[model samples]
Target: MNNGVNVTALAVFVLFFLLVTVMGFMASRWRKADNALHLDEWGLGGRSFGTWVTWFLLGGDLYTAYTFVAVPAAVYATGAAGFFAVPYTIIAYPLVFLFLPRLWSVSRVHGYVTPADFVRGRYGSKALSLVVALTGILATMPYIALQLVGIQAVLDVLGVGGGAGSNWFVKDLPLFIAFGVLAAYTYSSGLRAPALIAFVKDALIYIVIIVAVIYIPMRLGGYGHIFDTAAQKFSTPKSPGSLILAENKQWTYATLALGSALALFMYPHSVTGVLASKSRNTVRRNMAIMPAYSLMLGLLALLGFMAIAAGVGSGVKGFNAQLSVPQLFENMFPDWFTGVAFAAIGIGALVPAAIMSIAAANLFTRNVYKEFIRPDATAADETRVAKLASLLVKVGALAFVLTMDKQAAINLQLLGGLWILQTFVSIVGGLFTRWFHHWALFAGWAAGMVYGTYQAYGIASPATKHFGGSAANIPVIGEIGYIGLTAFVLNLAVAVVLTLVLRALKAPVGTDETDPDDYGAEAGDPKTQNAPVPAAAH
Candidate 1:
């Protein structure tokens, strides 16, 4: 069968795309800077976002199009296990409420642009900062690719994944156009573009999910039937799993949920959102209330079951389970509403993609380029390099999109979570205490990253054949759990043991630039507020 684009959905998707493009360009003016070329102003939107704006910015940053597409796809594919994101987000926020505030205080004090910047100052180790910076960028690359996967899922559902008469050019043209707009605005407006566009993205998503939650269940006979139908599908020989956590796999669920919750805030984009807030209060307020998105996620997860009941993506050609939610929207909704839902997914991808790029760029500029390449770079020079770096970051992520599989979002994102979680010991651990030696932290991170990558690479499955899975059977842990979490435990143990050994040897732990007062410092606390970046920080 020849694939053909749905004209109405395409039109609506383009319409919303144009709307955000305009807003993206216009956002450069939102917090009018005398010279927006300064990193503080351009890279972080002048740090002027109030409570509500921070709410939307963080919301948009935390949840991406992948969450919309992949989470449902997971549920659609694996029954109960897909709901791991809900518990992850729920557990993540409380942790953020406690830890992020101090990071924010220190960041605001030193005018830090990335988490690595804070690490550079707190530990006074360029190598340590470089590790954090590289991890942030590497983990983020796959994440941004997953956003494209989200876009591809929508395009596939609309019959635009290279239709029979259309070549690959025609199939991917819309995605390119959307990305071009995103890259342009992100370069011109920096953080403001995504910050402003996030409001629209969140609203459209809320509307779509609210509609899908209420309308789809009614259309599918009812919620009970939807669950029954899904449960029946899983029981068949072709697909075997329980709708609740399986007995032996219970630990898998527990570890995955815990590990993911720990990893969530460590992503650079999440930190970028928090740092962009106008004040510490803004960060605190947003954390407490941000569980609202978690609630939406629960409703969104239901759509996976709804898709199963509707027989969406059952045996469709070129269809992956990731397209399940898009297929459900396309199959069940009217053309116009389907367009709105598609736009939500498209806009959703753009918002996070832009932020992830900006955050990556900031890391390159602050921790890599300025630190090593040109220590004399002024804020303007740093900002210019960051802007160009942002464009490059997007291009790299686009490569992953063009070359990777449909399930790349799931596998790569899982890898991203695992790889990034290694930094938790350095960034989060350093935030609370300074006892861990820099060498010890770096060594621990190295051990975890190497083990996690090797383990994930060895697990084989039908989808990937190699590097095919994120879970494994382990000693002591009878159930299969996330390899990342297990590696993290190793990472922590190694760091603790090494720290004690290194300290006993009287080895240098690097200079601690942060004063205890810095953690508790507020906006008006001059000692921390004007804390200077030391000469050796980089």
Candidate 2:
């Protein structure tokens, strides 16, 4: 386990990296659209992805390398609580099955590229859409940065980079190079980059997980031995007990899963994935089937227990718990198989990082640039701006990876989810009902965002051993709780109160910018033909 790089294994890893990089750049031609220059084409793969393609694309985008590394790592450290991720994902598919079809219908009917675009039209408020767009872009950047960290962990395991006193620039050079390639293909191909590369990413992930879950257990003795050893080790007073929920954690676990399930489809990146589908049925069918990824997640989380049985932490010092899976495989598997698993983690990072950057860039271009800066921008002009914005977003994420501690990715991602979840009350709720006034919604969003940040800043994680986000200890509530859910409650209360006040005062609630039927019409349908093109972007 103290060994340096294996040259043959290193070669395999590099070869696969180059192959995937080529595949990523070549994606622009895979499903070449008629024009390929418009936002609808470039930002959303021409809105023409079939069921299988979207299944892979979204699977790749959502169940990421971070899941592969971090979930097991969590299990290695904490036990059953880590399985929170698995149940959350499984619960999510059922909820997505219910909500995403409505979203897809509304998006396609209006030719929406970003959810904030739909929000703008539905609420008739540029300010509200701007907030949602900015939140999406901000939240997405940290998630992309986490993907980079996933790749970084694989490289560190492969003995690629980093050493004592290595400058930040030198330590992270490989990550920067990886980010550069991702940013390039995303700039050229947008959503198509991840769409094409997702096939490879998911295939490798499945192969590695199936092999690891079965192969590693036999190597370590048997599945029963793995669980028995894990129980013995963790059953110590300080360890996370039994592979089941403790009573205190059950509420938080269930609520986190439910809240995250609600917030998952609300993410702009999630919406970007849905909007790229060819039809509403594609979205629904994909949701119905996507829980297969959750099953994979369950298998992956068990690796943490396997790692424990392997005595993964017996003597290691200052070791990253996050890197436990990679190290476990490196110690247990043959060199060649280890190489393949590492590459799976590395390439897994690239797929979603590309898609996330593309999604965030599209939001900035359509919602911010065209809305405020260049009202006369053409299709070509918007695509070019989006391409450039994609690069900036990647560079920003790279800056985050380098300047902050590597472990910051986990905390930042939780913070990002909390920030974006605040948008749900306005964006998701507004799609079904116009009951909430636009001005009131904006005010509520502002209040919720502040409360969410304050709570997140107060959270502490053993991973960082510092203050972080996701769950917070509310003062009067007297214990740690989920920040996003708390803030969302505040947001709803404010919106309701302000709406009633406005109704009583007979204040102008602003005219609806979109008609009801527009939510159900296809792009070329007569209903949307004469409706004013949305004047605001992100």
Candidate 3:
């Protein structure tokens, strides 16, 4: 990487950053709502986005800056293992297609603002609801912090921020500026801020990826030479990775992919994107079309191999693997276009960070505060509290970035997936049938959370002593697999056994507030007419 600042790249990055900042603030007026003070308006974009809007929103929300930076970074660090993300994203849509529309339908019918709202209403259990809400907030903090890490990687490449040895304020000023802008717009405009800015973020990402995949290889003597170079590097005896999956690694790869696919929508932000759609069909349509992002992801992952071909970080001391892709762009692209790629990474961080904060805040306001503290809070009051909670959520995420080890932040994010997946039985299972007892599901979630955390905490990596990785050896199977998936198996087994015993003993299952018809309701139906008005209608 250049020791001096790339002034042209920094200028271009600032130009695009300022543009998105303006758009984020202006979004508050884009779909002006009649009662903007209501949680329905502030939290879910008035639950009125159509197919295209919902598509972009969900796309931007899921394919974040971290994915842009980390996927390639993983590839740069571990060869084909990084490609696991591509398959997992492909697997997620089909799996989600089967159930997400039902969630949207029920959420629309009942005006549920968060997944915890659905959980509380479904099982009528405050304890179960609280755990789900807390898990979401916990999982989301590290995820949001990782987005800041993505921005920092780009800033480091551009030489915008001072070096790591500098005073903390000088080192992190750019990131704090970006964070402040994101938090301010999100607080002022709520979900609309991210929804509006997502269009720009996605467009820039696609453009940069398309250009990089084409241009970078040509400059490197084509894909043939790029692959040959990458193969040669990994072929070295002491190299830690390979160009293809080793036989022993197959189980880990498959289980991680499957576990990730199942866990993707269990996240509160993913559910928030689905709930914000205009109708059940909007949710279904977006699911069908969302895989276009996977194609981009596949192309983006090649940048890792491309970085290897370009010899990025070849002999740099204590080089961070996360900076490999950013450095590659700076080395190959002209300074001005390098700024654009950096901006894509920077703005990519903003869209998801905004949505994540909003999603976590909505969880806290609805599930924790309103459900427990003040059951009689009005819509306006909920909106007010959610806005403040959004700011606090951003502050907590900033703490994760500023104070914690970056690797630890990443490990927590991995744990976030494991943590969030534990909720699948309760949220998804409750959608189809009330067969599982609420207390039994809660017990199952607790079992999965404890076992997953314990196993993850015990696994050690070269970088850390505890909480090192997500995969571990299965108990009876005696094969290596994702700890999350194994814990999930244990979770389901417990839920099933306890459910059978509880049913036989005539345990009092909580009342289900939903009817079969609620799962099929759509926008403008008489059943949903009393729901929040579409923002566009105002």
Number of the top-ranking candidate, with TM-score as the measure: 3
Tell me the tens digit of each residue's lDDT in model 3 across 357-452. 999999999998998899988788888999999999999989889998899998999999999999999999988988899889989999999999
Q: Estimate, for each residue in 84-196, the C-alpha lDDT of model 1 and write its tens digit.
A: 88998899999879999999898888778799999999999999899999999999998998888788778877877575676767868867877888899999999999999
For each candidate, what TM-score against the reference?
Answer: 0.96, 0.94, 0.98
lDDT of every predicted structure (CA atoms): 0.87, 0.82, 0.91
Task: Say which prediction, candidate 1 or candidate 2, comes out ahead on TM-score.
Answer: 1
How does candidate 3 fare on TM-score?
0.98
Which should have the higher lDDT, number 2 or number 3? 3
- Residue-wise lDDT of candidate 2 within 101-165, one digit each (tens)? 77777777666789888888788888998999999998999898899889888878777775757
The alpha-carbon lDDT assigned to residue 534 of candidate 1 equals 26
Give the CA lDDT, 0 to 100, for residue 513 in model 3.
85
lDDT of the structure predicted as candidate 1: 0.87
Regarding lDDT, does 1 or 2 come out ahead?
Answer: 1
Model 1 is weakest, by summed lDDT over 10 consecutive residues, at 529-538
Q: For model 3, which pairs clash?
A: none
- All candidates in order of TM-score, best leading: 3, 1, 2
